[model samples]
Target: MGRGVSGATVVMSRNKFIIYIGILGLLIAAGYGVWSTLEVGGELVLSGVVEADDIHVGSKIGGRVLKVAAKEGQGVKAGDILVLLEPYELNASLAESRASLKQAEAKLAELVAGYRKEEIDQAKADWLAGKVQHENAERFRRRMGDLIERELISHQDYDDAKAKAEEAEQRMKSAKERHDLLLAGTRHEEVSQARASVEMARARVEILKTQLDETVIRAPVDAVVEVLDLEPGDLVGAGKPVATLLRTNDLWVRAYLPEKRLGYVQPGLKVKIRVDSFPQKNFSGTVRRVNRQAEFTPRNVQTTEERVLQVFQTEVVIEDPDRLLRPGMNADVFIPKTSS
Candidate 1:
């Protein structure tokens, strides 16, 4: 009877101990659930960095830097000069082109207007003189021929007279042709050639002018100068970046959302933004875009098996009317949570 009572007591103790362990495990699981809800269940907020479009401003035509018109961190508007290069050669070339264009235009005008009245008169006079000389030579040649036929002149003398007559006749014909050409003025072909030359000169001048303008490097957009270390006499090549600018008109936050939470946000929806610089303040931002391609990247996870997760990149444009935000700032973006 004593042994049975002891055995029953031991069995009851073992059962009570098992019940206590079961109750402790339930309590621990409940605590963990409550903690997870407090930590990340309320909102889908994530961290992001502020970024802006960086523009590299430079000249298409390279040259020795004459002057640095703007410095780093300087705010500039469109068309503001950021640097100036030596344009001495370009200016000289432009002037020379302009003079050539003027000369070509003058020639074209002259050709279109024909020859002067004085020139025409001079040509006509020459033609008439040639005709008189030719007639005199012809009369002499006839006399020489008649003398040779009658054996009154030597063969050499007759030949000389004949040659003079032929030369005189040729001179008269050339003179008459010159006079006729002067009367006809310039041909259409000549006028067209002259006009073409003028156009070519003008085109060269325009190209030079454009290069001269490029020597003065100007801001293409309204931005703040981020990098401008150049000074006078710094030689740079064409299309080399001389200055870096950060556009202040639009700032964006680059964020990565997990593929599982992709449906939580879409474009055109507003979200809350906060930065460490102004933790108390809240900034408004709109979703700009979401990348369609998912990438495998490591996320903050405790277990090694859950280290990598698929995520999509998202761009959110921040709206700051007061212009307080800048690039490279750490911002906390609160993504709205949705069960669906």
Candidate 2:
């Protein structure tokens, strides 16, 4: 009886020992399987930050800033009023230029229209009077010639009358020439000169108008105002940066990935993104671009030597960005393998 009891106790002990060993082996295999799943054909996450398109707004002309309509962090659209400059000087210049142009145009019109009607009538009357005097002189000269031939008058007196008749004929010719010129109106050369003057005046007016229109500054694109450099009564110089704007619609993240995974990462590949600011949310995005060249990681990045040894730059663009994501915000991107 004693031997049977001992044998039974031994069998129970062996069974318990075998069961414990089997459980331990299963636990080890499960741990190894979990580790292998984490290591192969998995997603690699890279760190980056959100960025926006940047721009600088400048003034074309120098003037005192009369009003600044935009503030920092303000959203604006194309053609929205951004700034207003002191336009009094520009207005005065434009007015003066317009007046000068009007005067020039008036002068040009007068020149092109030709001589006055009264002046032409006066010339005609002078010509008629001179013709009458010439006819009277010719008749008197003829009579003097006949008297001289008949010996009724001295030769000196006949010569004097002939001279008077010739002088009267010359006066008539001069008066006729004056009448013809006055009736002909303005010459082609004079009209051409007047037209040129009008064109020059118009060009000046147009230049002044362009300058006046530049006084009101408008936004060039749909963006957010990043900076404001001037206020009311502030003097701004030509070519100086008045404000800084950033395009908010096309936001992208700059990241680096291992060169070994270059085949999997390409433009148009879908990606998963997470921002440090929004820990609970995951952003959907795509690989918009990738750099061809490989470069070392920047010294500022906190990465292991293996990761920094060689990496390729990549740009991921977010499809639907909300107010939460902004420029300079830290982000992490997950690039899944083909099998994943």
Candidate 3:
């Protein structure tokens, strides 16, 4: 009797366990059905691809590539150095500019300060010497004239004496002019010209400095380097893109909506996004804009002939707080139909 009772109790316990498992399975199935409905039932889904603005980074002033700091598919922050150009030429130019600026500034300073005392003194000395030479030459020429009149000196000797006197007078005049100019000091026009030259030289130096800074290619926004085909020895031209970066911080979606849907869609409309990679997750976004004009579908539509007709381009700005989304990912946008 006791053995039978124990066997009965065991059988009863197994039955209860099976019943509990069946009830749990039914509950799970019911919950999954509800979830599927919630995921699939509501909203008009529009398909698009994740897109971000591609930033082309290059040097404003070109040179041979000196260093490539980042590579393809590498994430980078704003202001990060992506590449460096050979600064030897720019550095040399900057040095030359500095020298030129210094020379011009020195000239300006000299003009502003006027002739030094030592220079004036030397001019005075030169004038005195020239005067003495001129007086002596004049005396000799007069003597030679008297000799020639008496037929004591040859015609050639009198001519030579006259030439020497005239040369001495010209030299004396030049020296006197120099002395007077020193005493007169720098003229306002001369100082103005020197100052202008200094300003021009300084401006050139600043321009070269800015060009030197351009040799370093920096990221303007947080991005991923999508293309970097340059190495250390590669020569790149000015204003030519060396690397292509996909801006990750500011991402949006580009979708094509049928012309008929234009009435229901407008900017600032709330939308949900779903990517194939994360089907269970939904991202928030807002309609940024809708194209005014319509264009034919880019490619043959797989769904229906109607979808292949004219469509308006739409931009949706995705809100990716955790930065979980990336460019080129195919996405489904769920835009709520507003009562038109």
Candidate 4:
């Protein structure tokens, strides 16, 4: 009977130990669940890739590449020469335009100045000679008319004299008009037309000069050259990209957050960013923007559940001015939930 009692006691002790272990396991699991829920609700982490302003540098006009002043991964400042296009054709066109402009200008100046001293003197002399010829013709016609009336000359002879007199009179009138025109400088309409021509030629010259300047490609902003597609002899068409430049100052990370976490993120919120390249360094950034619409989870999403959940795109701008971060670098962003 005592053996039976000891055996029952051992069975009871084993049962109690098993019960205790079960309770401990339940408590640990419950604690882990609460901690995980709190962590998810209080903070959010998103993965993204770094991005910068990509500027495609190209020519406004087509030409062969003459020289490349920059190379891939080169940092350049605003107004720095990035490439040079063959300016041979442009220069030649410019020279021709300048010559035409000079000619137009000289013509306009001459018109404005009217007739010269020698020209005016010659005109006056021609007018006097025409007047003398007209007077002599008039006298000869009068003599012919008197002779015809007395039957000393035929009707045909008198008609010829009269015709000569009329011609001389017309010549005199033309000479007098020519002299008057020379003394009148230039007419307002003529001067205006000449000035218009000069202006047109001037505009052509200015346009060609501008095109020539465009042959020397310059960086529009301070950036790093990300691509150099042309060499010394490559033919680049008009508006063709010669290089791609990334603005170092405009760096950001393109990240997406779960739709449910939208309320916890907003523009101007402070965040921390980390990159695999610089494991020890954490960069500071501010939420620059958050997309209004929700979309399917991106292909790079880590969790299967996240793939089905709608996500909003978020742009976090890096505050680093030294350009320690580069585009396409995978980054992790951590944002703290703000108390509403």
Instruction: List the global CA lDDT of all models.
Output: 0.85, 0.81, 0.85, 0.84
Residue lDDT tens for model 2, 130-183 = 999999999999999999999999999999999999999999999999999889
Which parts of model 2 have CA positions greater than 4 angstroms off?
A: 1-47, 112-114, 137-178, 257-324, 332-340
- In model 4, the worst 10-residue window by lDDT is 30-39
Estimated TM-score for each candidate: 0.72, 0.67, 0.67, 0.75
- Candidate 1 vs 2: which has more lDDT: 1
Name the regions of candidate 1 deviating beyond 4 angstroms: 1-46, 135-166, 264-284, 296-308, 332-340
Q: After superposition, how far is residue 113 of candidate 3 from its true place, in Å?
A: 1.3
Global fold similarity of model 3 (TM-score): 0.67
Q: Candidate 1 on 13-122: residue-level lDDT in tens?
A: 99999999888676454332211111255677766789999999888899999999998889999999999999999988888899999999999999999999999999
Pick by TM-score: which candidate is best? 4
Q: Put down candidate 3 lDDT per residue, 212-243, tens digits, no spaces.
A: 89989999989999999988899999899999
Which scores greater on lDDT, model 2 or model 4? 4
